[model samples]
Target: MISLLLVDDHPVVRDGLRGMYSADPRFEVVGEASNGAEGIAMAVALRPDVIIMDLRMPGSDGVSAIRALAERGIPSRILVLTTYDTDSDVVAAIEAGATGYLLKDSPREELFRATEAAAQGETALAPTVAARLLGRMRRPSGGGLSQREVEVLELIARGSTNREAARRLFISEATVKTHLLHAYTKLGVNDRAAAVATAFSRGYLSHDNNDE
Candidate 1:
């Protein structure tokens, strides 16, 4: 059985996940946490093979908590289970070392398979999310921003808020949100920080000044 930990703020959600894993003979829900901090603690103490993580939390939040774990070089793999969003948290989580992203509403079977895949060092994302991102990449615009919805992504990497990114890009916030969603899908990351990090690691964000 693949040992796993479930982390989410809602007791109901955690309970549901626990129940789901209980039915899957290949998985064992070894521990649980209601927030990122407790999740980190449980992760350190139990050393689960994979962590099913919600991207938001009260105290430590998902991304920072993941980063803390990574900084400590813990070997546990992280699988993000969150609603679709393109922002700092998702980006930061991926940058911090999460292995995969899955929508919280993904069918329980997919979640289970994803957890199993993660244990073997594989990655997965929701299909619609992946398609949307790929469509943007096939766009005909020549500027890096052309084919890829990059202008807002640049702001994302610089730690800009959605409103700030919209204003800087001369687009409506809703439009910016749309672009962010697409970028998140394409980058195969759940949040802006992770998307940016993936881009950087993949050499998409090439810049001479590393200070920014």
Candidate 2:
């Protein structure tokens, strides 16, 4: 059976997931955690084949939990199951080491299959989430923000306009704009200021440079 650890803040959700997994002969609910902190502890102790993680929680939070589990060398594959599918949520969770992303709207069978795939260390993305990731992958930056895109954002963080950033980076202004656009898409921001702020918050840019 594919062993699973259910991690969500809501007890009702946990109960529902537990019931679903417990009913399936191919899977088992090995453990349940009500928050990200508890989830991390259970993950370490249980070492379930797959962890069904929620994106938000009261304490450690889902992204923090995923990053922590990966940092602490926990080998359990994490499959994010949440209601939110925004670029920030999906991108952050995947970058934090989740094996897959699935929305709560997904059919019960899809969730079951996603858990199975996650147990096998496969990528499982809901249709919309997959499209978002696919769009990011198709951008000039591709997947995560490219090195050039990050450099552009770093320059912008220092109050450099597109022309100035291009002059500094020795690239054409058009190229600089392209990089910023890609950064906007990848970082899920609408404008240059938001992009720069998000880049800093996500460590794409250094916070030490507070110059505006």
- The candidate that wins on TM-score is 2
Best by lDDT, which number?
2
TM-score of each: 0.64, 0.67
Tens-digit lDDT track of model 1 for 101-187 = 888879978987888888998877666445444544554354233333666776777778989988887889999888878777766
Model 2: per-residue Cα lDDT over 96-131, one tens digit each:
999999998899999988998998999999987887
lDDT of each: 0.78, 0.88
For residue 189, what is the lDDT in candidate 1? 76
Off by over 4 Å in 1: 87-89, 132-212
The C-alpha RMSD of each candidate to the native structure, in angstroms, is: 11.6, 10.2
Error of 1 at 6 (Å): 0.8
Pairs with steric clashes in candidate 2 = none
Which residue pairs does candidate 1 place in steric collision? 87-192, 90-191, 91-191, 91-193, 91-194, 92-193, 92-194
Worst 10 residues of 1 by lDDT: 139-148
Q: How high a TM-score does candidate 2 get?
A: 0.67
